[model samples]
Target: MRLFLVIFAVIIISGCDDSNSKPSTKLSEQQSSSLLTIKDESVIPETEFSIVFTPNNEVEIIDAYIEGVDMYMGRIPLFFSRTNKQLQYIASGMVGVCSKNEMVWRIYLHYRKNGTQEGKIATLNFVVTNT
Candidate 1:
């Protein structure tokens, strides 16, 4: 009975560990499929994050906004500047806060030369790391 209990506890602990450490972003074919890479793999709510854009064509970030998918977090504008050559887009401050453990946030990246009206929409449904 002791051995069985220990094994059960071990299994429960291991199962609680987060498996989705690396967040994945999905974009349609028209949106270039995979051009946006969130700097840090793990993202937290109401935190600043930089998005690195790697496009084949000449790109210019006009604007970027993030919205909560599962809930209504409102459309918040992310920070971005043409001069900031390093982080094309940056999001911070009152961005997202959810009641659940995981909240799906989507970023609508509006950039020039992305071959779409206004900008390409990318749904970044990622798991928010610990508080």
Candidate 2:
């Protein structure tokens, strides 16, 4: 009888846990996309820059592609920062070679919430210049 009571108490306490409860405030679980751009006059090679992308809803980056001169020939490392809410990319040395040219980066983002299937492509444009 004591064992049965202890088991019942454990189950009751576990049931009171609210770890699976929904948040008090509702968060919109929609899919959306927006363009991220840099207004700098020049993007120096071998430098790292933070690219910010704001979506209408929370989303995670899927993949990225960059185009401009030979910028795509080499590996352009990308780091995702959730705290700062930005994506950091290292400019390849080819950027300076592509000076006076336009560099475009496309990022694929996906929103996975509320059983909704939504995706967005964020485009970023920058001008490679030597200052």
| TM-score to true structure, per model | 0.60, 0.45
**Every candidate's lDDT:** 0.54, 0.36
Highest TM-score: give the candidate number.
1
How would you encode candidate 1's per-residue C-alpha lDDT over 15-95 as one tens digit per residue? 222322245666645675436667775664435566655555656677676666766645666665442554344444233
Runs of candidate 2 with Cα error greater than 4 angstroms are 1-35, 39-41, 69-77, 84-96, 99-115
Q: Candidate 2: give the clashing pairs.
A: none
lDDT of 2 by residue, 16-131 (tens): 11111111111123322343434233444434444444454555665543444324433233444454544322222212133223333332233332245655445443444223
Candidate no. 1 TM-score = 0.60
Candidate 1 residue runs with Cα over 4 Å from true position: 1-22, 82-94, 114-119, 129-131
